[model samples]
Target: MILSLLGRLGRLWIVPVALAVWELAAREARAVYFPPPSGIALHVYELWFSGPPARLFLTDDAVAHILPSLGRLLLGWSAACLLGVVAGVALGRSARLSQYLSPLIHFARSLPPPVLLPVFLVLVGVGTPLQLAGIVFGVVWPVLINSIDGARYIDRQYLDTAQVFGLSRRERLTRVILPAAAPKIFAGLRLSVALALIMMIISELLGSTEGVGYRLLIAQSQLDILTMWAATLLLGVLGILFNAAFLAVERRVLGWHRAAL
Candidate 1:
């Protein structure tokens, strides 16, 4: 246990060390675009803990910025997960439906979410709705595709047994199909979480008045390198936290799958 703890601690140091080296190199090279780690850390600390001279959001604090972004991410991701799983299950279970929708799904998936930002902006007028829409659009495909594949691959023997027992359609689906497809669905959801974060940032960068991305843009415009770096660091932290939480949930929910693995 001690060795495992030490190994984890050592692994954590790797990124900080690599970052330190990068900062030193950038400083030695005297690149205006590249700031050192210490400078970035200072900026992050101030932005998160202190307020700027002018207060835009309530409390003029870091939590203000982070909460909005997190809220959007949650709302959008939840919508995508619910809709994607339903649609994927439908398509996966029905060959005729899958064939009918194949071209449409493929076409939509081919287009990048950024390409639709202008349309969303025009229709939704650059508020929470637009942000949510963009995130949902961006993340739904991976989840939908994965769910379809997972559901389609359900064991024929299981289905045969369920049918022989004269199970109701809903019972068979809830007890058998969904459980079998859950791991794949969860995998897709995990991937979607990352994508959702990226989409949220991108949308905020484009025209959002608030969020970590928006604050980063403001810092850049004001030439506040430290604050920019701080925002970047916060984003990294958020991603790591989100992934860890997701993995915990997956492990608890899918404990039965451990033996299979």
Candidate 2:
């Protein structure tokens, strides 16, 4: 077990080596904007991870910034997933509805999410609502497109079999269609996770009293070089953690699909 674990970790050898090189380069250059990784790590520890043990080493700043970002990210992403799946599946199942809405859907999808920020703000004002609106609008497209394609392109054999079995429309969608489309849906979901993270940050940067993005923006404006770097490093770590966790879930959920294939 130890050897296997070591081998798996060994595959990440480049990460530490790269950080080491960055540390040495930053130290040699002594640039104000570019601090060493060591300094950034220390600053991050002090800024957010220096609380008591009971609090899981999370300081006030950490609770204030990290929690809001996490809450918004989760809420927004969940809504987007629900909306995308329902809309996509419905559209895919109905040729007439898709024909009527295709142009509008494509037009909306082509516009950047940030461009709609003003509209979101006008509707929901600032704070959590705006952030969620931005995130959902930005991240829903991938899932929407993939789910539509997946549902639309299902093997005719499966549909015919479901019909022959006297399955209801709801049953066909829930059992046959969804199961067969799992792979493509998962692919879109994984992409949306990253996009949700990004949109969360962007929304918070533009508006919000506290969040991970707020910390980064403040640090940048204040010219607190180490804190800025630390915030950026934190974001990178969060991305990796989110992706890894999602991948694990995906693997488990899709294991049956893989076996069948």
Error of 1 at 98 (Å): 1.9
- Mind giving the per-residue lDDT tens digits that candidate 2 earns over 1-261? 999999999999999999999999999999888888888889999999999899999999999999989998999999999999889888887788888988888888888888888888888888999999999999999889888878888999999999999999889988999988889889989999999988888888888788999999998899887888898999999999999999999999999988887
Task: For residues 1-261, write the lDDT of model 1, one tens digit per residue.
Answer: 999999989889978889879888988988777878777777666656555446533345666688899999999999999999999998899988998998898898888878988889899987788899999999999899889988999999999999999999999999999999999999999999898999999899987889888998998899977777788888998899999999999999999988688
Error of 1 at 18 (Å): 2.0
Pairs of residues at least 3 apart in sequence or in different chains that clash in candidate 2: none
RMSD of each: 3.5, 1.6
Ten consecutive residues with minimal summed lDDT in candidate 1?
51-60
Show the colliding residue pairs in model 1.
none
